[model samples]
Target: MRAPLLCALLLLAGLQACVQAFYLPGVAPQDFKRKDVIYLKVNKLSSIKNQLPYEYYSLPYCRPEKIVQSAENLGEVLRGDRIENSLYQIQMRVDEQCKVLCRIDALSGAQTKAFKAKIEDDYRVNMILDNLPVAMVKMRKDEKSNSLVKLYERGFPVGFTATTSGGQPEVKFFLHNHLRFTILYHKDEITDLARIVGFEVEPFSVKHTYETPWDKVSPTLNTCNPGRATFVTHDMPPQPVKEGEEVIFTYDVRFVASDIRWASRWDTYLLMIDDQIHWFSIINSVMIVLFLTGMVAMIIVRTLHRDITKYNQLESGEDAQEETGWKLVHGDVFRPPANASLLATFVGTGVQLFGMAMVTMLFALLGFLSPANRGGLMTAMLMMFVFMGLFAGYFSARLYKSFRGEEWKKTTMRTALLFPGVCFGIFFCLNILIWGQKSSGAVPFGTLFALCFLWFGISVPLVFIGSYFGYKKPAPEDPVRTNKIPRQIPDQPWYMNPVFSCLVGGVLPFGAVFIELFFILTSMWLHQFYYLFGFLTLVFIILLVTCAEITIVLCYFQLCSEDYHWWWRAYFTSGSSALYLFAYSAFYFYSKLDITKTVPMLMYFGYMSMISIGFFCLTGTMGFYACYIFVRQIYGAVKID
Candidate 1:
């Protein structure tokens, strides 16, 4: 017994050490000594205008002897991150001046053309050191305050066009080949241990003229001080990428001690945005929308109460039956809607997505999901969506049964396949487009298979189990019996027409959220970090309230008009907001972005379509549930014999 106990204790210690060694999905900080070699990893060449990312090697540039790729997670791959080793070198706590990286001889015509096109398209080079993205130090003046505004441009330009001093019409293109790095490290006074707290770089286009012979390893440059070899800042003429041109690449490194702590290192980088996000405007706009919705909702509830009272008091009297507006259609109101199966499928999927969003946002708001953990948000969303299948299946089954629908198998299949199928179809097409361009943004076939496995293996099974239990439960009886024959709905006024009413109903919900949508879109296409989960959660709640109230009000109007076909209209009334969302996206594309290519244009619209569809589902579900509850309460309150 003593011998076994010793062996078990030894095994447990080994396991604990192994777990600490691999603390998973997140990385810990490293302590650097005086001469530690720090590797530079090249990320994608990005542009806010084009809204598409290309691999670092897409443009012809200096290459290391043997390029090696770093392993990445699912979210990183989806986000188009391709971190790989580069030719540039660095040493921690050791300053170097004008160190030669590489010398590229005879730039090809294709390479030159590519460089020029990228410059015209406003591409920027992005490099990573110690997980910190390089940024350019730029200065701007505030228009309103009339003060100098300091800014850190996230990435430096790949190249720029410069006009000739002779005032010629032709402009020359210059490539940024030289970089100056300023690394900030925080050292513990007691132990003298240092941790990298910040990384910044200033890129310049310099044509170097060397007095010494060209050497692959060491080339003494006339541009450098040579004495100190640590304070080189040559303001030489820029080099243009041309056919058969000798382009030299060099970089300088300097280290500075900082007061920042390792834990709070990301605070400065995360809050590096130049312009304020304008939260006050967004909140005020949403409040106006809410105020309008509240008034309409109050009117609806009071009018409904008065109508119900009149109907209930005169059940024995013949004259007062026609007096109550909605009571006349009580018989036909409970009728199962057309395409009830489809409606159930859509609502079920919407419930899943809503659950996913709520959980993810709450986690983010609680600070459990930090931006420092790359890919954490995407991974969380995907995982939540998958697991939320249980709610979708249960709700779909219950709803279909409420509609008195048979063919359970058909409904189940539709619930499982419909929404996810459409989303995957769009995503796969976008991936194909990315693959055609030979970009790293494309999801690999293996990753696609893994996605399939998650869908089929995990989510599908959970959904099936929930559906089985849901179908077994008895469907709740309707408040009023559905008539055998439907009532002839009166001709509605022009304002109450289906299309006009849906369009009007959607406007309020769109008004409530469009302000927040702008920032979300900016974060998506412009590659800006958006972690204001508290505000996002609040906006979503407001959107839900808006959708529900507008839907209930419009549904009440339909019942008052003696038109009982409220099922599809209630869904579409809230869903029409998605049309406005897509339209807003189009306006944003034209007004805010400068994407000139057809492929990127298609990509922008395609992704926006997916976003719109998800929004439609979310808002529509809210409306449907609100209408369902309202109809039940109003009808159940009166004696409908």
Candidate 2:
């Protein structure tokens, strides 16, 4: 069973890599004709202070193009691929003239009434400052900043100059700045998408002097540009239009040509990782690993050797004495834990999580999962977790049976539902909050149903099958026979207490990865791109090794102190890192984030709890197995009558 499971995991990982590799674009660009229709996309707009993201297309004033094609796939919409054609039918023109290309009527009775309703409902105005065009552009590398700048769409900043010509206020519009755009080639055809490379938005005023006696004054208009040359009209006063009042808004569009190809678009989003920080983290983890290695070696070489030598010497002498320390508690060491069935279930689920994490990291390290492949990481993790249900069921059943548990069916059910149910419940509540905020981050109803289907249809059945096979096999034989009567545990030292040792043991594992944790938290909350999978994979390995080694050393100490209750202690010793992780998250929220809104803050902690739970399971499982192996090895080695 072990051999087959290992082979299946390797094969699945290889297949996933191959699938990802197949989707990668070829070096040579392919020729294709450009589609005449261009679609507009919307994203959440936020304030620098409040940091709350509200719906962008919530108002009826600027009606976004509705998605007409494949409406069934909620996953596609969640990924932000749903595009709609703009309501204003302005034709794309490539000329230098500032011509009146199109005129849009300001008032259509029904649409205007709907817009008024939306306004009364507190929908935000469609301002150019907050909107970003959903177009991908390959950026040219800048040597000065050593970073890639997105070639975004540019908008001309319009300013109104008012003058009294005939005893009335006459307002004339002026373009404050000019934009130079570039054309990109897609295969053999030229795309209508124009890239904006350079722009200037300095505050300047224009003054005109007439020959006739007239007073003239100019107020400076400060044009604000948000990196992409987009301008906002939110500062402009509302123009009230009476019945049949005409409002004319003129815009100047420009286009330039470039030789950049479309195949390299993914390069623009690539984030260059800081190698220094990563290397420093690696060195720190290595130092911890070395420290742990020394400790484990000392236990095996000095303490274990001395104990074995003294025991042998006493037995060979004229007067034979009973074994002391760890050997004294041999009969009760293998005794079944209280609520053994529940422990088995948790350990089983933890094993499943551990396997999923390992395989996912392995795939990411090998370049099978990258940010370039959208939703790849989540998709990979979800699939791997579901498929690993077999391990969860098998291990739980085996452990429970070995503990002389009779309720295999109940144990298997708990193994399948316990941890996963907790995660889903938290996620569902967070999703409800997102839905109330009307944020695009909310998962749709269909997607939720699909997730349920995946969990119940695929994962649950696999667990049952694994449990069935596990129950067919007899319970494993223990080297040290458990005593019929339970042995009384002696009072332990303060440092040797389960709680104190667990708290201390957790620090080393958390320290091994906390440096990397800063970068990960920054990526999550600060919206920075994280592409350092290789470094992350290394940190994960170091964390696993540290957890196992530390737990084993701690378990040996507890046993040497004649404490046989090492089951929960081993699990908590490494799992307590989750508590530290939550504490760090609280510190990070207060110190780093500018989020003032109650909803976003609640969502942050809600998600963090789920993450901490997963980390607890993964680390706890590693420690338990390490301690299990160490206990079995030393006890099995000693000869018993």
- On TM-score, the candidate that comes out on top is 1
TM-score of each: 0.91, 0.74
In candidate 1, position 50 carries an lDDT of 68
Task: Please give, for residues 1-641, the per-residue lDDT of candidate 1 as tens digits.
Answer: 65335434543543343233223232578888878899888988888766678888988888877889777766777888888899877887999888888877778889889899889888998888777778776677787899886556677899889777765578889888888899989987787778988888888888777865676666777765446453345467788877878788888898999988888877665554423454764576577556867766675567767776777674546676446478899899989999999999888888988988997787788775666656667767777777777778889899999998887668877877878889899999988988887777788899899789868876776677667667879999998898898888888899899999999989988988887788888888877777777778878887888888888889988888888999999999998999999999999998988888877888899889988998898889988888898899889998865
RMSD list, candidates in order: 5.7, 8.8
- lDDT per residue as tens, model 2, 354-470: 878888788787766654444466666776787788888898888888888899999999988988899899888878887787766677787888788768876777777778778
TM-score result, candidate 1? 0.91
lDDT of each: 0.80, 0.63
Error of 2 at 298 (Å): 1.6
Which residue pairs in candidate 2 collide? 181-256
